[model samples]
Target: MLSNTIGETKTARNFFGIHLSLSSDMLRFDIYKEDGEVFEDLAYRALKIAVMATKRKQIRNLPGYYKGVLRKLIDETYFKDMFMYFDVPLGDFYFPENYEPS
Candidate 1:
């Protein structure tokens, strides 16, 4: 059986603590409860940054390495303003959130 669970928890797929789902791929995302809308704006922005990094080859496919590079970029970009608000995609893994914050 092809298990599609995101993690061991029931609410693991919630994006930014909101509830929603990607119909085409079965991927879930968070929604804004106040307006019952998904967080498209921030998600879109984050995805764009990710794509740009891929184009520059600033990230590698190796495990852990890409995350390390991402953290560095986040640092350089002063993205700390929102780092805690975005969830790293599963395919790319994730950077250690505890990595010394400046």
Candidate 2:
């Protein structure tokens, strides 16, 4: 019964004689429960489920676009920073990878 909204809007003017606008809305769920030592484990499982669900939906709706965007994010310099900040290894994300793809 968790609910939240994430939205972002971007606008660009005079980009090749076109006004570009991009906006997105994502509804996310956050689980609330008693705090304890196992909280981290529960939170991690919840996040794993959420990300898998979103990736499935995106691929179903726009496979090509999703793949391209995912590839770009994977290739970005700051991609590993996300996991590093949380002290989690990149291999822990979904399928484990022996080596990062270029």
Candidate 3:
């Protein structure tokens, strides 16, 4: 069974850091992973979801989308040899309190 307290705080911080660094335009390329075709594919999928969510003006849902993507990627049955390198809590990807899309 999954335990929320296991590395949850660290994961949330890491994901929030990533969210801060990312822009919608960054989704146009496979920038999340450095090497490996599978990794690239995973990055592409995540970016695609982000792009779609942005287009729909549902940017707030990005964290949930990413969480779903991560969950799927982490499942051994979902990929032959791919594995999650890290974990990120869905709550970490929230938009900044003062953020206003321009």
Best model per lDDT: 3
| TM-score, cand. 1 vs. native | 0.27
lDDT at 49, model 2: 49
Off by over 4 Å in 1: 1-32, 35-38, 61-102
**Each model's TM-score, in the order given?**
0.27, 0.23, 0.32
Clashing pairs in 1: 15-30
Ranking by lDDT: 3, 1, 2
- For residues 1-102, write the lDDT of model 2, one tens digit per residue: 121211212111111111111101111213322322233333333334444667566534332343344334323522456545686666566855576667
**Model 3, range 1-102, lDDT digits (tens) per residue?**
011422366645544444434422244457624334554455456646655667777556555666565446534333455435436666677798899879
Write model 1 residue lDDT over 5-100, tens digit each, in one string.
223243233332331232212223233233322234333344345445666776643223323433454344433576577677655865697866
Quote model 2's TM-score.
0.23
Q: Which stretches of candidate 3 lie over 4 Å from their true place?
A: 1-36, 73-102
The lDDT per prediction is 0.39, 0.33, 0.50
Q: Which ten contiguous residues of candidate 1 have the minimum total lDDT?
A: 18-27
